[model samples]
Target chain A: MRLARVIGTVVATRKEESLIGFKLLVIEEMDPREERPTNNRLVAVDTLGAGEGDVVLWVQGGAARVISEEHRKAPLDVAIVGIIDAVDIADE
Target chain B: MRLARVIGTVVATRKEESLIGFKLLVIEEMDPREERPTNNRLVAVDTLGAGEGDVVLWVQGGAARVISEEHRKAPLDVAIVGIIDAVDIADE
Candidate 1:
């Protein structure tokens, strides 16, 4: 999974039948330092009630298919599965 | 799976019931180009015990749950499944 922040929402009227009920979010890649965001952006399937400005955890590829159980042909390369409130990084 | 190094670890106190004893790692997302680290990072479930600077392969979504078989409500989107010493991206 990667760290990303939901920047916007994607509206796709024509999509796969399996993806009809799933929400799509436009996420801007983020730095692990929790600094500024990056230029790259990705569209991900959201199932955890994430919204714009929320830091989220997203999965990609076959792993995504296993989570949402939808969007067989929805053309998504990423999926948001969780909303992260805090991270403790001192005990690595 | 993407290439990443274990930069640190995460410890959550009030986590979901299913994630009582799982280990989480702080990962830095690397550019596929292998250029200098992109300054991007992630927190992932570590089943392989990857150490700092070890490039690892991670699974997300249900694939992660199937691999770790824990964290039923732990809200993890990334799980480190294999430790990668090298990658031959030339074939991609």
Candidate 2:
């Protein structure tokens, strides 16, 4: 999983039926070290109820369908799975 | 889902039991437009029998757990869900 920070929310009235109750949030990709922002912003399905400015653990791809059985058929590519409490990188 | 190319395979003799039969592959992230390699290479669980040099659609997160009921508890974060036949991008 990659680290991200919830930046904003997305409001889509017309979307896939399976995505009806999911909260979509705009997330900024963060570098593993230092938590710096990198890459493009992505809209992700928030499964952990992450709020704006919260650091989250997000996953991409078909694994996104595992968020819930009801979301199995949703055309979702990304989803926030966890809220990070802390990140400690150990030197190798 | 993001585009990627299977570059190689990974061998983990000691891993989670749920991942016992899954094929682990090294994938190179590609740009959605031209399919050029970008960012970093990631190790993904292949579900569609994608071979080396094949392009695929991959997902990351708990949703990856939805690949199969048996894999619901696997400690996997990334998974290749589909083999891409073609990607057509229309000018917006």
Q: How close is every model to the real structure, measured as TM-score?
A: 0.63, 0.56
Q: Can you tell me which runs of candidate 1 are displaced by over 4 Å?
A: A71-75, A90-92, B1-5, B10-22, B29-40, B49-92
- Stretches of candidate 2 exceeding 4 Å from the true structure: A1-70, A73-75, A79-92
* RMSD, one per candidate, in order: 6.0, 9.5
Docking class of 1: acceptable
For residues A1-92, could you state the per-residue lDDT of candidate 1 as single tens digits?
66688999879898777678888889997766654687879888876678889877666765565543354455666777556666544434
Which tens-of-lDDT digit does each residue in B1-92 have in candidate 2? 45688999989999878789888999998765445888779999876678999877666676466556665778887877656565543332
Computed on alpha carbons, the lDDT of every model, listed in order, comes to: 0.67, 0.72
Winning candidate number (TM-score): 1
Q: C-alpha displacement of A72 in model 1, angstroms?
A: 6.0
